[model samples]
Target: MKFISWNVNGLRACLKKGFLDFYQEQKPDFCCLQETKMEQGQADIDLGEGMLEYWNSAEKKGYSGTAVFTPHQPLSVRYGMGKEEHDHEGRLITLEYEKFYLVCCYTPNSQNELKRLDYRMEWEDALREYLMELDKTKPVIYCGDLNVAHREIDLKNPKTNRMNAGFTDQEREKMTTLLSSGFTDTFRFLYPDLEGVYSWWSYRFSARKNNAGWRIDYFIISDRLQNAIKRAEILTQVEGSDHCPVLLELDI
Candidate 1:
């Protein structure tokens, strides 16, 4: 199966920038989007024939949201973590397939000055627990913009970005804790030591032109699915948002 994740930044803007063109070209079995920034019926997105769409929009207007488009229907679908605090942002959606569960999430950012670091920490712990509980039932394919650069190699200016929102020690360690528990960061698992590969670039300072970016987006699978990975990729050339799509191919 082919699964892809991208943080569109804003789906409405991406549509004007050739979102459908790329979607048609890839034709992935599943396409997951983060930071959709709009409510249902706000966009002219038509997956057209043979596909089903699921959306979880934030209660706030034009804010954080997520969606999934898949040709294969899932046995069950869940919106949010079933918690009032986290559910308000529409940051997570889970689709339970026959073989595994696919979760799309837009983890809350710590924000400038780490103003929201406390909330983000709570989210990290809760989300990790949520994922592990799902893993107990079946292997999982968790993908999205997790908002943390797990290692020094994950970002270009690691030294300067050390205390930044996404690269802060506290945030990075949460990712380490999650991975150590039972998940596999698919891209790193497949291409250990691959450098200068990134999924997100800031709009400021010609970041993408200089390849100064971070690999915060990911496709993390249950450790049990390591043998099933056929390919894991960061589609850097595809453009529509600050983040390029990350792809995963599984034998299962």
Candidate 2:
């Protein structure tokens, strides 16, 4: 099975920039999106027949949101983490299939100067707890923009970017805890020493042209599925928003 995740920044803008073409060409079994920046009724995504679409829009209008497109019909679908504090932004959507759960998440950014670090920490704790709870039932296939560069190799200039929002010690430690708890960072697990491959780039300063970017987006699966994972990649060539898509091929 093939799974792809991307943070589009804005779905509306992305569609104009070949979203449908990419969707049709790749034809993944499941396509998860983050930062949709759209509200209900605004998205009329028809990915042709046999595709099921699910959206969790933020109440705050065009701010933060998530969506999922899958050919496989899930047994159950859930939105958010079931906590009002964390549910407001529509950052999470969980789908339960026969074999496992598919979680699409858009993690919050810490923002410039670490403005939202405290709230982001709470989110990390809550999201990890939620994933752990689901792991108690079955394995998980979680994907999307995790918003953190867990290690030095994840970003081009890690030394200069250290202590920044996504590379802060606190955020990186949270990701460490998550992976140590039973999840595997699929891309890094497959290519631990690979360098300069990134999924997201800043539009400013012609970052993409220089290939300066961060591998913040991910497909993190339960460690039990490590052997089942076939391939993982950062599609740097594909473009729309500042971020590109990450693909995962799994035997399961």
Candidate 3:
């Protein structure tokens, strides 16, 4: 199966910026989107035919949200982690298939001066526990804009960006803990020595033009799924949002 995940920034705005064209060209079996910022039916989306759409939009209008488009119907669909504190943002969606659980998440940013760092830490811990529990039933394919640079090599200038919202040691340590607890970061597992490849670029300071980006988006899976990883890549050339899509292909 093929999977593509991108933080479209805003689906409504992205539609006007060639989102449809890119969708048609990629034709992934499943397309997961984050930061949609709009509720379902708010925009008319014609993603060709045979695609089922599932959305989890925030209670607040025009805010954090996630959507998934796929040709295959899931056995069950779950919205959020069932925790009131974390469920309000509409940040997560889990699709259960016979063989695996597919989770698309839009992780919260720690915010300027780490104002939301405490909440973000709570979210990270909760999400990790959720993923691990799900893994016991089926291998999990967790993908989205997780909003953290896991290691120094993941960003353009780690030294200068340390303690920033997405590059803080606290956030990075959480990611490390999750990976250590029986999950695999597919792209890194496949290309351990690769560098300078990133999925998200800051819109400021000509970050994209200068290729100063961060690999915050990811396609992570249960450790047991490592052998099934056929391909993993950060589609840096694709444009529409600040984040480019990350691709993962598995021979399941």
lDDT of each: 0.95, 0.94, 0.96
For every model shown, the clashing-pair count is 0, 0, 0
Q: lDDT score, residue 183, model 3?
A: 97
TM-score of 3: 0.99
Give candidate 2 misplaced runs (Cα > 4 Å).
none
Stretch of 10 with least lDDT, candidate 2:
38-47
lDDT digits (tens) for residues 88-194 of candidate 3: 99899999999999999999999999999999999999999999999999999999999999988899999999999999999999999999999999999988878
lDDT of 3 at 52: 98
In Å, residue 129's CA in model 3 sits off its true spot by 0.7
Return the TM-score for candidate 1, rounded to 2 decimals. Answer: 0.99
Clashing pairs in 3: none
Model 2 error, position 235 (Å): 0.6
- Model 3 worst lDDT window (10 residues): 42-51
TM-score winner between candidates 1 and 2: 1
Candidate 1 lDDT over 1-252, as tens digits, reads 999999999999999999999999999999999999998788788777988999999899889999999999899999999778789998999999999999999999999999999999999999999999999999999999999999999999999989999999999999999999999999999888999999999999999999999999999999999999999999999999999999999999
